[model samples]
Target chain A: MERLSPRIRPVWLTAAIVQAAVSGGLLVGGAVGLTRATDLADAVGLAESTVVQGAIALAVVLAVVRLALAWLRYSVWRFELREDALYIERGVLTRVKTVVPFVRVQHVDSQRGPVERAVGLATVVVYTAGSRSADVAIPGLRPDRAEDLREELRRLAIESEGEDAV
Target chain B: MSRLHPVTALTKTLGYAVQWASVPFFLVSILSGAFDVVRIDWVFSLAPVGFLLGAAYGLVEYYRFEYELSEDTFDLASGVFSRRDREIPFRRVQNVDVSRGIVQRLLGLAVVSIETAGGGDTEATLRYVGEGEANWLQREIRRLTAENDEIEADEQEGLEPDPTERPEPATAGTSGDRRPTHLFELDQVELGLLSLTTAKLSASMVVAVVTAFGGDAALGLVLSLARPFGGPAQLAGASPLEYAALALSSALYGAVATYLVGVVYTFVGYYGFRIGEAGDDLVYERGLLQRYSGSIPTEKIQTLSIVENPLQRAIGYAGLRIETAGYGPDGGGNQSAIPLAKRSRVERFVARATGIESGDFDRPPTVARRRYLVRYSVIAAAIVAAAGAAGIVWGLPYWYASALAVLGAPVGAHLRWTNLGYDLREDHLLVREGFWRRRTHVVPYYRLQTVSTRRSVFQRRLGLASLVIDTASSRTFVRGTPTIHDLSLSTARSIHADCRERLEDARRTRAREERALSVAFT
Candidate 1:
């Protein structure tokens, strides 16, 4: 099992920031209108003050929870290549284990977005047709490692197919 | 290339204007009617005015639309008041379907649909064109495409043929150098037989009629029928004799109606079904009133499936479908190349065409951890009992509902779990599914686009993972459940890794072989 390093937690932090910004903006705007309807000295029961404080608190809590979950996810997620198949294990509370055989592999694709590029990481999306939902995206891979893994997987797929053909 | 007639814009705009204007007219009518509570005469005047306006708008748009054509493209520039233009490339075209409505036929015009590989959203259509020009365009597109394919194939073979390899001796009589690439064509008898087995005549007719009537009329009819037959009241009380008589009469009526509808459906859907090989491509032409012709290059095919319904199984018939990269023009993701076929003949035809041996794949395994029928039966029984209970609560005859539910349990269960099987072998993966129409998809390892394994929380508890194999064709999805051989996570990971390695090796080998051949030839 190979786990993603804790340093990758920045991606989750970025997501949290975006979420908070949007939610916080809406909450603050609503609160501002409520405060305007009441005098600040007697604003204890003002809708604006309550709404703005509640929203900011919720955002902060969400960001904290997100950061904790990201840590757990990174620590739990592991992928290992065995002699004949590829195995992936992940999840915090509910464990998921998937094993894909080499012979069954059709193709492999690698993608990188700005966020991933900034962190010098890439994602690999493996697709299968057997199930309605067969695409699995493995993120947080170093580009060189991703390329190497891709080549290795391709080789295995062809070899297994050849063996089966015989 | 031809340009659209300038009048086309006028007609299109007129049509839109009519559509928009109807809203205001209807609103005014409703408002006037509301005011009629005070003065009824105003309502009468407004209704006629609205009606007249709508009719006038429709008439104006009807005669204004037109289009233009060129050697490599077609332009549809139509609008009245506000203009719009659309350009379609001939090369991007996948199918040219010509349809003649009664009105179009009377006017000596045909509607041409130009379909492309892009999903259904971007297709271009010509609402009305001269019948002669429509026919000419269809033929021209087909001819150009065929020529392009031939040239491509020749380039592929000529560029790489090894010197050590002996050139195939040119056949005598018909252009020795040019092999008559057309390999097979279905005559009327074959086409007729094929249609007999796979054609859902009634379903086709329903679809055609619904399309003809448009969406609203179709929805209205469905709602009318479903209102009475659907829901708990359907299973309610009756004496045995009365129930039997009702069933008998309904069955008799249904049989007669179905047969008549089937005839119309078959006639309309598959009026002139034809399958032939043109160069290296398989060309399929079908339709009753609207003739559609499409061609698929052999190389584009990812998988071939042979499906057999219980009725077809008894008659030794099958349906042949080819899975390709793009969505099919006729709505279905998988194209029915030979909609209905003789099982034996279709197998032989595929083998000859692809140079793949017949009977190379294994039948899906029948044995499983448990009999699927038991699970199906249990679920069916539960559903029936629940329905019967619901009926009883609704003040229906409990005994009658109970009897019907009990009788339906086995049948329901059997249908649910029927024909679920998967088999993995060397070279290919085979999956057979579907209760009524048993379909066996044979996917070659080479054509696979992706391989994946998934496990739900429940599956993980059972120590099972589902394997999925995908191809370029959107239709084919093969999944093996319960983790074949109870493969462990590490084993599965390694398997995927190995598969990826093997694919690369094969590609390298193929590339090396082609290089060697090229060098040898030079």
Candidate 2:
């Protein structure tokens, strides 16, 4: 099995931070809106300090948990290229092992998101001729490595053209 | 080059008129204050005109419809106003199915549905053609495909360094007079048994009758019958014994009626079921009123499914169904390759269909995976206990139902535990599963598109794994993915690896054949 780029940890951390920020903002914004619209603090018979402190503590704990899970997920994500197939093994709670045969692969491509671009990492996607769950993505690769993997897979797929993929 | 049978226009016209009648119904409902606040009566008069227009359109569409069969391609041109033409090469044609509805049967015509390797519904349907013509077309197409393969082989030999040597043993040894081989057929007694064992006899009808008149209508019926002499007051004063007797009789009546209806339906559907092999095509002819005949090239078969219900299993009988690429799209198309046969006969059919001998798949499956069975039964028992406790608390008689669960759990577990098995032969993998309706799927290694292993949260705890194998055929998805569940992790891993290796080998051989052909052509 091959491990992805080490830079992926920070990229995952950035994504987790963004997710935590958005969720925290939504929670606080919702509380503030309720208070303004209906005097929620007074109606609930609670002091403003109590409500604000509870929200802050909740957000902080959630953000910490999210960051930890992101790191764990980054560690578990791995992929390998075999002689006749490509295998991707990932997941934190429920592990998933996917294998796509070279003959069954329809195409391969590399994509980079904004954060991935900043972190100088790329993801390679393999589309297969399966009836369901037809595509698998192997993320957290250097752009050059991702490109090379894609090209190699494309050549293998072309060489196995007359094989019955179905 | 020719049109459909003259009777086709009548059937198509009726179909179109019925489809378009909805428009008139919508207009009438809206304008007559049936659905909204309006009161225009003139639109009611337009209903007749709408029907007439629909019929006219159907006639025009029928007139424009045309099909032409050339040497290597079948072309169809249809549509009333916006014409569309479709041409399918003989190589692309997968299977040809002939079905007849009541009207078509009455007119001595059949609907010929042409399927292709491209999935979805049949590529084209030549509706209401003479039955003989439909059979001829199917046979002609099969012959053409065979000839096409022969031409490719001959060209390859011409280009070979030594023309005398034939490399393919399978094709070389069997180039004799192509004759139809009678495989199996259902006799009167076997057909009766099969119809009796078929699961879910008119389930929809049972549901409909129960929902329609089960409660109030049943009570009213009892009361009305009782009121013939003394009216409602006397019936209200009836003894408890009388009510119990009435309920018992009604239940008996319902069950008997349901059984009779189911038997009649099964008989009609599979009256004269027969299956045979003609050259390279497997043919099926069956049905009582609306007889159907269909043929599928053996090369197009994706998987072989041997199905049996509990009753059939008890009597040592099974049904055979084969899945091709374009069959069973959106729950339509003929999927029945054989209606019913003895277990040994069905096994023979599987051998013929897969080219794997019966002895190869005779190895008993691993039985140590019964831990999954115990786990499932334990969960079921827990549910039963919980529900029974809740029912007791709520003052309901739950023991009657819980008794069923208690009896069912062990029986189900025993059946599944014993039946579930997987055997890997030289060229194919057979996975047998199901408790009441046992089905064994015979999938060729070359037909496998994907093979995966899944470990659920519970399976992980038990250190067990499941193998899910998928092919291109759609019927596999309908019956649930062909899976061999509950094996040790190491064993599952080894099996997965073995399948992958075999798949690679199959692909290499196919590629080599294609390369040889390409070199010959160039």
Candidate 3:
């Protein structure tokens, strides 16, 4: 069993906050604009200021909930590198556990997105011959660790090539 | 190094130029303020010049593309601006097909499509090869794939090649003595039945044609014609008698048109359809206009499917499909081994071809039925309520009549639940599902790529989960994955574990079989 780098928390939180903030800004702007352009505040029996403030509150609540979910998601995510296969346990609402055999590995790649690069973290993706679960990605690893994992999986896959997993 | 038939360059260049003609049109439109500043006639004239430039680019592309067959790999290198090289191992090759269209026939050329494992579609298309050369290449590729396996086996056993025993490629005798052990060709009666039944599909095509040309106005006319039987004739105040006559005439016309379309499509597709077994491979050839012939190696098969629609089921007829890891030339990952045949015969054929028993399936627990009932009933209720609301809003008469459909919800749920079953036999796993069009899938244990159990929030509340069985076949992703739904959580977990363990055993069995076969060949 393995855990992701602890530094991924900040990246996840930042992404969640940015996503929520943009939608919140749009909502607040739309609410304020609607009050000035139409009679929405009057129809809802609320003052213009109250409507705008309500929108702000809703946006803040949504952001907080999203942050909580992200934390929970991080806690639940884990992977295991077995002798013959790789197993992953993930998801919060609709839980999913996947098993990818070593011999099925078609290729492997290690990537560093802008956010991950800033945090000195990387992600490794393992591709398989299967159609649906074709690509499996493990994020939030130190760059050196991600490379090691990629090399190890590649070697293991080559060694087990005689098994004809495809 | 090998060069393709010289005419291939011409055909490819022409196709490339014609396809690229659109780019200049868009560019001109954008530059000329959407053709306002530029004269329409002038723009039209400029298209020819675009074609000329595109032809030049096409020539470069044709010259750049190159392919060669090596001892163990098929190498391809193609690019105009940058170099891209790929080497596909022979053992990974799944299917090799040769096809020809009218234009290719006129040119005395054919296309060779080679598909490999994990290759999305036709991995390589050697377009416009001489007809005789295409056939030779097809047979040669198969020989190389077989030889690759033997070489690997020998290498593992540390055996040196005996030059005296192994024949030279140039002198290898090509004979036609390898005839099919079992063969099936669609008869006239079966073809007629297939055409008539499949016209139901083309009925949708008739509707689409009506929609494309007639649009909403024609639909309204049809609706008015249909109104006498559907409800009161209020939309069109014409006399009921005249409307009923028009409705009958249009209905007859629709049926005839649908039947004609269906017959043409079916006949054209399945004309001279023949499937035969030549050694360990299933060879198929079909089509009236554009001919297609391919071979599917038995061991490369991922699963076998037996499909029966309502009409076919009533007549004891079924269709058989073989799924593989990669797509064929036409991008149909699943090959229709038999479009229509007797159910019993198809079953026997599949069993013989795949060498696996189609065992009886075990039904899910009764509680799963309750869950399906609840889920389907809820969906039916939602649809009814929405229709009722829409009816009232649109001032439709008898708004409450939609409620009648909700009562039939239990029937739908029962059919769905009854059809859902799975069997984990000794050698293979069987999953039978689908109510409208029943499909029974026989997946050998070795082809079970991954086994997973998923639980949604709703499933958790109902103490149920779904077990998904994945293969390397591409159809598993596009269509519904072969999932056994509404199993009790415990049952799902146990089945998942059992399936994984069986998969391990199957792998060992596969290795042993390959070893034995190699030894026998040696």
Which has the greatest DockQ? 3
Model 3 CA deviation exceeding 4 Å by range: A13-69, A158-161, B1-10, B16-41, B157-180, B199-263, B329-332, B476-480, B514-522
Q: Assess the local accuracy of residue B469 in candidate 3 as a C-alpha lDDT between 0 and 100.
A: 83
Q: B1-522 in candidate 1: lDDT tens per residue?
A: 353323344454566556655655567666667765545445455555555565565455444444556545666665545667776655445455666655556667776666554343436666666777776766666555444434443454576676544333312111112322443345566556554544354465565554457776644543344344332223357444444444444445445555556655555666666665544345666775655655554444567787777877888777677765545544434667666667787777555544345543322223222234455556667877765654544433443454555555566545534455545544455666665767777765565545555554444555544444545455423431212322344544565555455544543343333223222211
Report the lDDT tens digits of candidate 3 across residue range A1-166: 7988889889988998898989989989998999999987875567999999999999899888888877777887788888888787777777777777776777889999999999999999988767766437898899999999999999988876555667
Model 3: lDDT to the true structure:
0.75
Model 2 C-alpha lDDT per residue in residues B1-522, reported as the tens digit of each score: 879998878867877776677687777677677655554665566666777888888888889999988877889999988899988877666778788878777667888888875445678898878977887777787777656655654565565556345544334213212555566677898889977876554555774576467787766765555443333433466654455445455555556667766777778878888877666566777889877777776666777788888888788888887776665422433367667888888777566545555633332234433564576678778878776654554343434466556566666666676777788986788888887777888877777776777776667777777777867665535455588777788888998899988876765454343333222211
- State the weakest 10-residue window (summed lDDT) of model 1 chain B: B170-179
Q: Model 2: residues >4 Å from true position, as ranges?
A: A1-80, A90-94, A105-154, A163-166, B30-37, B40-42, B80-83, B151-179, B205-260, B329-337, B352-394, B398-404, B476-480, B507-522
| Cα deviation of A90, candidate 3, in Å | 1.3
Higher-DockQ candidate among 1 and 2? Answer: 2
Better of 1 and 2 by TM-score: 2
Ranking by lDDT: 3, 2, 1
Chain A TM-scores, candidates in order:
0.74, 0.84, 0.86
lDDT of each: 0.55, 0.71, 0.75
